[model samples]
Target: MDSTYDLMEVLNHIDPSELNYQDWINVGMALQHEGYSVDVWDRWSMNDRRYHAGDCEKKWRGFHGAGTPVTGGTIVQYARDQGWTPPYDPGTALDWNDTISTEGVVVDKNWVEGREVTEPRQWDPAKELIKYLETLFEAGENVGYVVKSWKKDEKYLPADKGAYGRTAGQLIELLTQCNGDIGGVLGDYDPEGGAWIRFNPMDGKGAKNDNVTDFKYALVESDSMEIEKQHAIIRELELPVACLVHSGGKSLHAIVRVDAVDYPEYRKRVDYLYEICKKNGLAIDTQNRNPSRLSRMPGVMRGGQKQFIVDTNIGKETWTEWKEWIESINDDLPDPESLDDVWNNLPDLAPILIDGILRQGHKMLIAGPSKAGKSFLQIEMCIAIAEGKKWLNWACSQGKVMYVNLELDRASCLHRFKDVYQALGWEPKNLKNIEIWNLRGKSRPMDKLAPMLIRRAAKKNYIAIIIDPIYKVITGDENSADQMSNFCNQFDKVCTELGVAVIYCHHHSKGSQGGKKSMDRASGSGVFARDPDALIDLIELDTTEELMKQQENKAVCDACRQYLDAHFKWEDDLSQDDLCSSFQMLNYCKEKLDKWQMEALERNIEAAKAKIKSMTAWRIEGTLREFSKFDPVNLWFDYPLHTLDQSGVLGDIQPDAEQAPWQRGSAKNKKNAKNRKIDRKTALEEAIEGSNFGEKPSVNEVAEYLGVSERTVRDRVKEHGGYTIEDGLIQKSDEKQDTGKPD
Candidate 1:
């Protein structure tokens, strides 16, 4: 599909044996559609064993172009699927969203100067062939070579599978004994056409990919560029070449070391080898990807030119070394810069998206357990940014924001925004600045979703992108540090590409999160906590019965005052104590208002009571990278909104799991003796039932479960008359006979 690279060059990358009948025909049709000659198609077809003399010409005549004709792009895509990389101009700059692969780039073809390669002056044909064999194979490895050729339409082709089952050492010894007369050692070859030899060791039978034993060397030959230029790029790229042979034609055959262990790996390595060569201005004949594919023999003659050794062992010594060197130099990481260079003029920091909480072009994660109203909190933040109002306790910069709703349906998500707006008593003046994308059932993993999000929000000028819940879009195992790190990088990509803050919410890990640090509460790997610039964790606070009663009384008083102010002018007449008391306020309202008005006020009072019962308390803890630590923020989740608690009622409440053992004991001490005994009995029963030990629970196990000393467990057992402890185990007195008296 990339027109910069020639179609003919790509065609060589596709192996005919790999394609079915239709696909092979499609390749020919694509070439024909591109205005290429039938002879070109026929010549390439001959590489396949299925080729018939007149098959291509017959297919070519019947090919009338269709309305949507298969263009050369089809062939190009096929080649790419076969691992052909199209040459790209080094001057072209990559777009923000383009994926950059810097691997296997060893040469800057634009700057490399060609190196000259000259033929051997005193050509000893026998010695050249012997050197080629020793450089490529072990002494016992079988060699496959083709000396016999047959003329085909003015071109020489290998007549058959050629000679095989001969050891390299045997051929070397035979050539040495045959003197300068090479024809006596091996079958004779046409004087005009040079002979060819397979680069890899064969199985002593036939020459095919399956017949090759060791997948060591592959041929890199290209005729598209000047011979000297091909030679220079190959060396500059540091291809692990074993033998560099002149083909006695325009191309040079550099037997590069792939060193693959098996057939599949061999194909893979060959593809990688050819891709690097093509990118660096060498157009390789990709059909030579087969492990048993042949290259021109060094000691041979074609017409008037001599096929001799150009150079031997002229690159990196091994395939791995070459590949590592290439990738090490081609990485996109920026070079280190001296701090002294910018000491006087450092760049300004990123602008604040949420004052003291997050910066623009950064990442923030809000973590909480289920029913913590985390999603609602995120929606509130979005509205705050859009209206330039305060989010929770932090002021936000005013700008358009994108809210990605991955957890809720379109209707519910839309209504939630409206509900939150009404709950906050804020006018919807900046509704146009908030855009919601509801993907409840149509969500994809974050890796795939990031680019799509960036593309859509690019022109929207959003200062922040808020993902309501990240669980729906998480890609890999949350427990795997490496995988989760990659998953979190998607957020970084969005922030960097769109220059906006990325704010998302995740559920806290299972069990009580109050005991864990704010950074350790988020579910999965620690990377989730560390990867973000700011981590805000919300833990539920323990609300006592007395606190709930206080909240209910305040709610009722506020409702009564609102009704009296609207229907009767009682505020000026009533004392402050009377107005604040729920009972006094209700009695005053009943005396002044009519029956219908009183009934309406009673309904309002009841609704307020129900709200108090449903409200949940929470504390916000932050781990910030850019700002100093702040005190924990207390809040009340009242249905559709989270309001900061200003009354200090929640300030004294500790997270249930974070309460110290001594604090629990002091609270227990407030109960009467009778109730205290009942509590102890309940604790003993729970410890026995919960213990993993069957039937009779061990005293040590019960003590560990209750977080008490063994002596304390014995006292509790003695107080509970139904249970007895003996031999360090507790059992019901009715179930087990008392043995040698209870300990």
Candidate 2:
């Protein structure tokens, strides 16, 4: 089993909550060292969505400062302090040792004392013994050993059981103490059988994983291979083997430090080695291909004889070379298509989500000043979208709408909702497709809140998300491009990944509206305006005319009421019918026109006057006018109703003058009008400079080339005054013109 697997299994079984304080602290230390941060606990708590245990920040304060060391014991202590209990045995909690054979068969050494009185075989350590041992230790491979004994039989000891070594110092000490045969796995040591891995061209150890064994070297093993044969093969392959070792048995192992690709590719190289073995009639031990497989440690005795170092030809190579070698072996691997394939596979875009206002899977921004009815306008659109109705003049693509109001408390949000609902006369049930999240104080940044938002959108099938007051979740310097870009990227992920349209409300920069485009007025970095699919600005309309009209109407109603009160005794006990009769009498007594008298014009006029006066009392009451989405002339929407008649569909209100000075007429016109003066001047200059007719082209030809009218070209020509057109060509008067020369 993999060491990581063993660790995880032990941790999974151990109930942190059940551990004693000290044990929990120890576990925390271990986890911290393993790359899990204290913040992870807080993040995990937030995953459930029902509760927030935000105390983790306080608890882990100052824990990650520089020079702070974390170990298994300290982790356990921290876990205990945090109320986590250890589920595994404390003694072996951090153990990563593999089990090794400790038993050896008993054998008699008797008759040898008298029979072989000859000289006992002498053995001595090599001069490079220490250097060779240091190399293996530095390589971090698991070293195995056969314990020396006075008896003939010996046992192989495993490094994982503390019998061999887990560290360089430990290995040095073991070798010095035992002075016995040393053997180990050529690959890096893990508690598991071996690690399935990949190599990073830049940094091999940088790609460390908690699950797999990390290696700095790769190993290839072959059997029926003598030391000479292994050397020959290494030389033939031009391999960068750090060393080759002769195992006690018939197999020979080649150890190459992994400097290029990871273990997976290294495994392929091992397979290549096997193929070479087959072609050369050299047998290979497939079992030793396992990265964790044990091999003979250099400078160690084999079967009571001094083990020889077969060859040592370590060399330096660039990451580029290793990468090429790794890739070269992958010729047999399947190749997949690239990102261009996706570009080639796309279909044309369909109609926008809400005509020109919004599009599916895109982002929009609704910006305005505070308390400028930005939310009101957004809510109107939300309701319209949910009902599949027209918002002003733009047709809404009906879908589920989610309004997330992070800047408003629940009560305030509901108050606004109630006003809109009452004005629209929509019942609560009619708004079933609209969901509101009044997250005033409970909101996270866009990046942090994406998961929850995605979940809700998926669960409720929301097609659009209205984030009122987008700055509430900005969580960074709004003016900083980098910070804003980070926030925008997260928001875009939500929009594109979930295929939901987003309309986020933002504020206009203070005093930024003068001479600037409506979209440019949005606060923060220009990215706020540039990144959105559509930019809409809501501005408070100047209602001076409406206020004046209301006052004038009030005066008329007061005068009419006073006249009826004084003449007809319009006091207590006066009925509506009586008031109407009195008004008719007053009107009937007016000087009648002779021409209209024959047609009973006086009676009709008196009845009309009476009807007007009768409605005066009720007409002064305020009512919200119906808003329209398509009224480009009047971008401002919804005002109080009045009795005064006007030309507009909704009372006297007209669309405000172009909110964006450059945006006029249809979308095409606006696009064409963008930098229109500058673009035209530049185009005209270029056209004049490129003309080769010894003069400029005719106004008609220039107009056709530029997609402009002849009149426009003529006006430009006159304004410039440097050139004149005669017949069908233009001539510059300063010289004889181009002369039609190739030069």
Candidate 3:
């Protein structure tokens, strides 16, 4: 019996309670015939309620060999009836010691009818040899053959290594020249002992594994089975046989095509071929595993039997096709399920990972242009998930997270995380939940990294895996749809294997992104945007000077209030309006505080000014699959932290590329025109107030301060309509003015 399959595993699949008495006894008989201990049967039978503890031992002792003994195939068939399918994947690379399953059995031995073999009526020895050579080898390749045999333990064996340096073309020419006399071309052979020929092409040297030029055909001969049964099983299995020849003994030599590239591959493929053949009931002769092993030659006589070709090209056209077909038949893919069967008892949906954003075991992409703080946003999300805090406006589930930092050095990446926590004013309470894998210079392609990541994170129970700046590990051309689709599947593999959400960041394409949809802004093929369950795109907002001034004033006022809270008691003396104005706050602090305290306040105000100048505004737009589309969120990237814009200043700002071409110019012109008028009015007022310390300013002085000519300044004062210009002097008008405010 072939031990490639585990009979115990097959027996486990059969429920004893589902089997009748005769069928249950047949299982025991099969196990006993296959040489298993009686204990195996007793343990398996314990599953049935009617099983007696000592019944198996008594039955085992009486199990003598019968005329037609039951075999392990009976248990395999019973398992199949019980809905037990074998687990196997043909596409997976097979190791040398891996157990081969019988999931793809192509032939049923009990029902397979024999395929009869017949002798040729008018035998042509030279023609038969020519056909065999032409089918198995190229014209320029070397062929090894032996005609002499020696008796070894009552069996005829090749006397020595045969002639090695004869090309197939040369032999064919010689055989054709010597018609009707086979011995004239080479040497005479015993009529009772058949000639032997190596199936694979040789390298004009001794016939050994190393001397084989192309690792082509492998011999699949089984002498233990009847000739007719072997023939039937070989064809039914669809072995890619180049030539099927009768050995003129008890077996047929199937020269199955392996088409391996080298020696190691040849060995692996031959092992797989033999295992498949054995599983399908053709017990392969294990000795014929070497590439240069010999098989019976056609047109030869062996013990009164004539060796001849039975068939050619009997199965699949190539080795790869046959292997794929076998794998497809026995793949571990689940069977199609009917919707009606599961409609009432539907499975629960995956739990939310980021509320309103994504689910556990899903994927999300964060895309933006360079220096848009995309990586910082991902790190913030990682922290939020670790602490069960809100990331931006969405709440996150708390758990362990892995931050795969492929674009930063170890120290920089660690420091950045610490710096972000400090900037956000969050304590390091859940530091243990975060795992950082910094692969700055050691990053591999996503396909290669996914397996290593899975192995390390198998039992870690991570809720999310965040990869920062995925361009470092991108596998193929970003522009190719198919290639990028394959590249994105690596994320799917990681998600499926670890059962965690995968979040990564990508950069947007060049040029303004205001016009494109959030999904279209991500650089590269659309697959990058569409493949993820949620896509968050960050585009820069055009910050106006008025908004910047408002931010700076707010920053200075907040800094003053923090300084006063730490240093002095100012709340009792200052009103809300005084604290809100930067000018008024500075005057009050300088008047009431000492020099040292005022110096400290000056430094804080300077830092606040710088922070406001360095700030960049962004708008986050989302495309979600599991939830409804959300309103675009506004954010201020204040260096190391992204704070939500609570002031509503960015609410009216529009992305440069997001607007339609016709609407963009007109809308922008209207907004810019109104802002310009306000800016001109403010500049004139400030200039007039500063000239000569609170006196009506001269037209020349105002123009110089405003960086314009006197005529431009006069026109601006006239346009203001709240101020009058006369005699090279500017003065405020007393009429009830518009004040640039809406009713």
lDDT of 3 by residue, 1-743 (tens): 63645888888777776455677789889999998999999999998766888999999888889998998767876776556766842222222223324466667765778788887888998888888999988899999988999887557999888887999999899888888577776578887787899999999978888899999999998765567878888988999999999888878999999999999999999998987876676766687898989889998889998899988888999999999998888765779999999999999999999999999999999999999988889989989998899999999999999999988889989999999999878888999999998888877788778877876788899999999889998988999999999999889989987899999999999987888899998999999989999999999998877789999999999988898889777698988898889999888888878999999899999999999999999999999999999999999999888999998889988776656788778977979999888898898788889975888788889888888998998888889888875555677777335556431
Evaluate residue 662 in candidate 3 and report its C-alpha lDDT on the 0 to 100 scale.
85
Q: What local distance difference test score does each model get?
A: 0.86, 0.53, 0.86
TM-score of 1: 0.73
lDDT of 1 at 634: 97
TM-scores, one per candidate: 0.73, 0.41, 0.62
RMSD in angstroms between candidate 3 and the native structure over all alpha carbons = 14.8
- In Å, residue 373's CA in model 2 sits off its true spot by 1.1
User: Model 2, 1-743: lDDT tens per residue?
Assistant: 12322333344334333233344344444555666667544443342222236545555563553475555444443333333445543333322221211111111111112111111144333323445556544544434332322222233334331123344445566556554433332223221221111211112222222222444455666543344454454444445666665554444566665442456765776566455433333334555565444445545454554444555654335323543554455434457867787887877663467875667777878776765567777777787788887665568888888999888778877777777766666555547888898788888777667656764576677788888887788869999888998888877767865788888888889863534666577788988877777776654433443344543444344444554455455355445553345343334323222344424444444454444433211101111112223222233233211122333432343224533444325544645665585576688877766654444667677777778888877787766666666655655657334555421
Tell me the tens digit of each residue's lDDT in model 1 across 434-478.
999988888888877887787678788989999988999998899
Residue 474 accuracy (lDDT) in model 1: 95
